[model samples]
Target chain A: MKEKLYRAGDIFSRSVGLILFFILWEAAPRLGWVRSTYLAPPSRVFGALWLLALRGELARHALISLRRVMLGLLVSVAVGVVLGLFIGYFRRIDRILDLLFQAFRQMSAFALFPVFILLFGLGELSKTIIIFWASLWPVLLNTSSGVKNVDPVLIRSAKSMGASKAFIFINIIIPAAAPEIFTGIRLGGSYCVMAVVAAEMIGASSGLGYLVLYSEETFNVPEMYGGIVGLAILGIGLNWILHRAEKYFTSWKEV
Target chain B: MAKIQARGVNREFQIRNTLGRKERLKVLEGFDLDINEGEFLSLLGPSGCGKSTFLSILAGLDKYDGGDILVDGRQLQERSFSRGIVFQSYALLPWRTVIKNLEVGLEIRHIPKHERRRTARQYLELVGLAAFENQYPHQLSGGMKQRIAIARVLAYQPDLLLMDEPFAALDAQTRENLQIELLRIWETDKKTIVFVTHSIDEAILMSDRVAFMSARPGHIKEIIEIDLPRPRTEDIRNSAEFAKIRKNLWGMLQDEVLKVQSYGGYL
Candidate 1:
């Protein structure tokens, strides 16, 4: 019974926190902390979200963003997993490519927006490539380290049992390195979202990022607030999906 | 005839110190030994005395700087599967169930799938792990995982078994129990075995002969024969013969242990 009360109290506290945040934000404009004409209140933002949904604009924009994210993330995981395996397995490859990758990784994702815009034009092609490039490094680097650092004792045991090199890599190194590789994928997925949003905000005919930029430029303050809120929800939802995936894949890990 | 023999073997590693000075570190020098068919020989030494280094060379996992090691009078070669080694760590594949882990060697040899499963099951039963065959390594105890490691080795059916302190990572009670099980397996297989270990009591319990070794630039200091009868029990460990053998090995090893400790990572 005490355990049940503890769980109930925890849930109530979290709900209270959420309600208090909304109340403060709503009260700020009513109390004239800032011009209501410029920032808009929570009530006004909800109204704008409802209107947009009624017209189907929100769904169209969300679908565009979601499709772009799916394509970019799929290509990145495949390429990243393959490239990481190669770099981890062979020292010669790692030596030649590591410095170049490190240099490119240090360059900011937003900094590449202008370059990608020119290379592929301000189209879906440009946005997709930007997202792919932004997400690649974290996944590749982490996966490489994970595979390279597998226990040598495990490798020795495998070899002594008459395992060939290919068998050891598949049955030993790949599984041992899986947890770290999953971590890389999670990080890469989030970066892909951030890059796609930045690309859409800069220039795009459609997407959730464009919705926010377009509303703000035209002085639709409530719509702008609603779009930002939608983006936060989207980010949180994607992160939740990735967290579940990592948990599922690494179920064999001790901790 | 002896199943495995080493003659005038040497091993050296080129290493860089903290100050970036390159040095040729000799791990084993002029090491010679032989283990008769169906005999258990423990290469006992202090840490850094090259027992593990010697075992790696014998397993064909690492090459020596000089001289030759032979199994049934054949030279060590790359891709040779004549020797099976068990490592100090459990080293069981985390993703695989016990049965699959045991099947790894047969897969490498491209054995038929049905045959691989059949062979793995046989060995799993041998290690008393048939009930836990579907569980992953993480789900098992340390001793259970080591038993899976043994099952994997036995599945390969190599004629010479090389173990590098295989029970070192386990708790004391588990180590004692596994030592008995290992002797039982040795009795059944009648394979030549070369075991490396640092524990004097363990060496006394399991080996037919114990080769005491010296520290860095390692070489055999003495090889003391154990004349204990078969079907050894915990009772044998408290016997006068065990005490005498332990004392002799300890005396030979005392100076080497101090030398290694004094250097404290210098070597």
Candidate 2:
């Protein structure tokens, strides 16, 4: 009985806002304060969500959306890490390319969707490329800065003790820059999800973004709300997972 | 033969002036010193007097525009394991545990894992930090962190130990405690130590000889040998001889301190 009460209290404290929001959502439409057609009631949205799951369509869309983000993010992570290492470690490369990278970063990734579609041919390729483009800067920017900002005193101390360049890079530079890199990765992770939604809306036949668009067009306000809810849930879940990864990797950090 | 020798060593840094114009600021000039093996020598000076800069050049971390520095008859070029430094800020890798931090130089040199662990453990004990092995740098106090820095450098077993105001960040009590501990370890290790500091008392208490440095474009003005008895303890600070030496050094530093004020303000 004590354990049950403790669990109840725990759940209540964590979900108080969520519970209240859902309560308000249910009451508003039902009491005719808000039109159900424009903003579906909580029960209707949940019911539409249940129907999507029952038909396995939600699972398929979530998987497809997640897969696109994963592919794009993987490419970004690989490219960002390699390019970041080069840009950070090689003074000449950084000096030459810093301006160019900064100038190109001024252009929004979505602004180049038409360009990507033309170059890659509008299928999964263009969508993934757009997501990759959207997310690359955070990782690249964070990583290079992380590498650059490693305490010069630490490097000097290491060097004074005859630490080799290769040895220092592996043992010092990489680990020192990790916290910043992980932060970039988390930021990039969020960017990936947001970018996939935009890319999916522009050209995709499937995915959660398309589902939301289709539901809106068909006047299925409940399903549209369900799609929005799914995106929110996906974003939260991704953030939580990435946060756990960051904690595990940066276990030594005081923060 | 001197373990380390600097003859008319000069350094000039190209820095932007207040006018946003590039100017050559001479940080070190006509600097001469002879450091004997296994002796604790402190460079006592005013702030921005280039004592740390001189130490850096000796450690091969910075380039000297002119003049000569020889370590065991060989000229300095780049960093080597023969010289290890303990920075004012401790410079511990926050990502590594206390024991692992000590293993940095050992790991870099490709020492076997078992031996590295043993060496780190031994130095950890030397610094009286064996209990805190698993803890990260941020977990430790300022004094504790500096102790770890000392242990880390000692673990590497450099022949020349260069220190830049290693205890400056610590409180009075902690600084005194580390100073005593440092001497005890120095007795055992017997590395040629070139310690740079602004504190007159710290220079007297910890060093076998204190080299008083002049104002910016710094060079040794005088080297005072402390004939105080060995195994210096807390009681030595109260000794008449210690007070005399302190007074003498303070008089030397006072002029340099005034010079620093004339330029702008003291560090």
For all predicted structures, in order, the TM-scores are 0.93, 0.96
DockQ-based CAPRI category assigned to the predicted complex of candidate 2: high
lDDT string, candidate 1, A135-155, tens digits: 889889888999889988888
Tens-digit lDDT string for candidate 2 (B1-267): 999889999998889877899998888999999999889999998888899999988888899888888889989868676778999899999999999999999988889999999999999998888999999999999999999999999898888889999998999999999999999989876889999998988988998899989998889999999999989999999999999999888888898888888888632
Which residue segments of model 1 deviate by more than 4 Å? A1-16, B113-115, B258-266
Q: What is the TM-score of chain A alone in each candidate?
A: 0.93, 0.93
Q: How would you encode candidate 1's per-residue C-alpha lDDT over B44-162 as one tens digit per residue?
A: 88788788988887776788989878778777765667678888787777877789988887877788999999999999898898999888888899999888888888897887788
Docking class of predicted structure 1: medium
**Which number leads on DockQ?**
2
| C-alpha lDDT (0 to 100) for residue A120 of candidate 2 | 93
Residue A46 of model 1, lDDT score: 93
DockQ of the candidate models in sequence? 0.58, 0.86
